[model samples]
Target chain A: MKLNERSVAHYALSNSPADHMGFLRTWGGPGTPPTPSGTGRRCWFVLKGNLLFSFESREGRAPLGLVVLEGCTVELAEAPVPEEFAFAICFDAPGVRPHLLAADGPAAQEAWVKALSRASFGYMRLVVRELESQLHDARQSLALHRHSSWKAIPSRCKPQAPDHLSRGLENGYALSRDCSSIGLAEEGGSRPAGSGLAECELQGPTNLLLGRGQSPVSPETSCFSTLHDWYGQEILKLRQGWLQRARGSQPECEEQDRP
Target chain B: MRYNEKELQALSRQPAELAAELGMRGPKKGSVVKRRLVKLVVNFLFYFRTDEAEPVGALLLEHCRITQEEPSGFSISFIEDPERKYHFECCSEEQCQEWMGALRRASYEFMRRSLIFYRNEIQKMTGKVGMGHGSGRGWLVAWLTLCCPPHRTPWSSSAYRKRPGSS
Candidate 1:
């Protein structure tokens, strides 16, 4: 029998933003209390549905110890300009001390670069992806920008007859200049029970309101093809937002992790 | 299309291969062939015949602007030289949109970086920004302090809320 193939790997944390401990300000530098940066107090991560589950604490059932990538920057040592705090390496603290390592040497200087690069990767990618999606959506919408347009009928818009859509309802298209929209007392008839008489005129571009109760149009088909379209867009926006966040917190995968 | 070995080697990331129906030269003139794979290496986009390395044609992204060509097409134009461009028709509208959007974004980033580089070079010549001055880092630290999470409220509940852009 073949067992699942697995191997151990090490993902060296980048010295910069990837390692920036927003919480552990006291125990920083080389070795103190490890700033639980990535998911888990250690390294490996898990994903439940679309949400990435990283270092979770028993105290907070929600994902705790999560790191967010704000941006990236590089620090220079032995610069032409002098500073108060040189390289401060405080890694010897007990359990998670937050401190900054002040590096004077060239080798130590690179640690700052690593940290910046690490922290900035996810931020940059998200920014780029967001821009890409925005541009794509803008261009797509531009296509539909001609004069007047309406969405194709969705399944939710299946025609269902109500007592009030009552002018010889045979065809789905209610070409009633009389019923103008769904419920403003057509010509002489009194406004129906549920539909609050909102003046809906066919002339207005966004005139389709789901008639309260008197619409011959089913609750599905009441508000034109717009409700479904709006819902779809909301879902898409939510997914994109969640994906951008998850991408920020997902564990850093190193070269060695590849089989 | 002559292959440049040294140039290919210098690319930072492995090339991402994609398939696109390339419309012949000019504005939506003719049909596009599905046979060729488009190679995206560094900041250049070009297509090679099969496994051959040399590009049959290449488009520099520096001044290129990818625009939707009215009804059913998209084209990229070089701003400096408008005549130099490639118009392609995607299999579907979405495919066309995604490819164009990605390329446009990459081009924008390239332009931004180039501008920064040029500005830095000018500064160096003028001796405004001295080496090892640590001005960049100083500015960065200030920005970070303003941006750090401590200054902002947690965004847990509204993380997945619908944003305005999608519609």
Candidate 2:
């Protein structure tokens, strides 16, 4: 989130109802669409209710995710807007938040009831935790970017040279390898922390935001629509392979699950 | 490494659940059964089964080795105790590839140690038989070092995972 964008995000978030909402000024997620070299644009997210919206241009916009909170995911291929690239939006990351609330439509009572129910409540709480952590990470990244005063350095992450990767460690895509079983202590045991947080991406605890991934942002959505879409699905996909493995487990492991 | 209910529910879902189902190797009672589940939390890939959700079997990546088998499967075993292995089989080469990729990425730090250890082992051989360019043993050791222990254990998850709505 840039300096100005943070203010808008703060207002939007602060003004809205406290439950089921989150906003972040994003630099885009993995596989963002291509953009021109230096656009200096960013995105504003309005995660209200079940919809996660990435409103572009920040001007007036017609009905989008706000139209409906139905759970069916669709890929909008820049239908009316020629200037936009196709993007997908989903109300549920599926296995990330499972609920008995059927796909009939908005189960207002059921959703609220499920929100208080055991599994669904857990799922919603988890989503809150995820968004909170993401918000924290975004703030931390912003802090790092402003580590030095702007008068001294416009941005902590100065755009590196095009051939930075070839320069090796100076400012490039450096990789660290490991083989030890996350080397846990010999005492007691470690649990899977939890599930559905499938992205389980190996983001380094030490200055990972400085890692070679964030591209210069622009107000243009074309570069980030795909990426945000990818982040939406991939972030929830890796850890919860049930959607993938469920196809095989029915008969293969039915006996084992019976007990 | 801290995850909430949703992630916990997800972990209790498939693949990991399938692993738990498969990891149930001992004799079982119909009414009361113990299921060991796979949890990739914080820095550790833990295996636990209990009424209280604790891992009964844990394998530290620091002392482990992954051996990919013929067709479509791989086994993660303790290097210190090879007999203790967590073997997995995939329906296809693709699934096998994903599992391997996730395992390696999760245990990357440990694998780095193995890389150093194996590279040093390869270096010892190259030193003994000088890099004659055409030296078969030297070349073989180098090739094995690249493909065998760490570098080319090519398991892919982020790449293999199917994208949503791209059909």
Candidate 3:
């Protein structure tokens, strides 16, 4: 298949942080002259996510070889030379030889093997999904805890804004606790506007505030609305309990003094 | 830069996350929309001739932007050249949204950012929640070590080889 070579090469040379990097002795790989003897050539190898690129030297501007570390196995293998701390990246494809590489020490060899083994797009996605579910569970429990704690306090001592209880569930920004403040109104007013959607995109991690952004393809209901409704249910249940208590104590205060 | 095309070809044959015969057009000027079997395998979007088993071209979803086009269509352009977009026409608006969402989440960088965000959130939460709530922490940290041996995680080597999500 015709791959986007220009973009691929540009990605290789991009300023993104390298996952791992070191000089490794290579043998029987693409762009390297094969040797009958076991004396492999030494080159600088950099691991960036799933792509493994090799450079001529530490300062080499261009990459010599690119290996997409997918559908492959990284195994500790016997090197051509003795005590070389070698590992091989073996692919399942027929007629394609495993790329043999040797690290400087046992530590480096183990590190390279670990990085290369986990360097696949699927593995990364798996971890992200796992964490996503965990965060969801955490938020659920936190909301439950907040509800119970809010119940313990007397209705007379209740906070001015019952809405703060729901808004506090949000992670990235601090919602205004003062119900009558202009800040809270501005913040609440902006949420449903179409322009607010861009600020809420979870596409890039550079904007940490957008981490809790709703998935664009999800149903029209924002997570904020879902969360609001969820907490609103808790508030409703609490309100009913408080109303019964207020009615039993003093019916006169029901409308004017009830929290 | 030299890479093994055979390895990538083998990957293209693996089960896809999504597969459909969509109206596709290349970034080239005057390119016409052609019926192509597009397969999303991991982070690569491979497009094949309707009748062929092998793919004609593969676009790496990394560093690429997926934008929704008008009327049941979407275009994918790279960060390198924003104007050069590979347009795709879906049969329905729902399908277009599905394609765009999948394509948006298809990049390694996007996955990485998500992982980091979740990792940080989980870490911050574990401190507050404590004990049993942090069970996922072990798996996150041990992901590298867990995949060290031949024992594969669900999305690891064996899973890729198995090609689970063919549709």
lDDT of 1 by residue, A151-257 (tens): 44322221211222222111001111112111211223343211111221111111111112232111233243453463354445544443443344333222111
Residue lDDT tens for model 2, A194-218: 2223112343211122122232121
1 or 3, greater by lDDT = 3
Question: Can you tell me which runs of candidate 3 are displaced by over 4 Å?
Answer: A29-37, A149-259, B128-167
Interface RMSD of each: 23.7, 21.3, 13.6
DockQ of 1: 0.01
* Per-candidate clash tally: 26, 29, 0
| Alpha-carbon local distance difference test for all models | 0.31, 0.30, 0.61
Candidate 2 CAPRI grade: incorrect
lDDT of 1 at A125: 27
Give me the runs in candidate 2 sitting further than 4 Å from their true place.
A1-259, B1-36, B49-52, B90-92, B108-167
Native-referenced Cα lDDT, model 1: 0.31
**Predicted complex 1: CAPRI docking category:** incorrect
Model 3: per-residue Cα lDDT over A145-255, one tens digit each: 556643433221212111221222111011111111111222323222211111212222222223234541122332444755543443455334434433453533222
What's model 2's TM-score? 0.24
Please provide TM-scores, in order, for all candidate models, with all chains considered together. 0.30, 0.24, 0.66
Of 2 and 3, the candidate ahead on TM-score is: 3
Q: Which scores better on DockQ, 1 or 3? A: 3
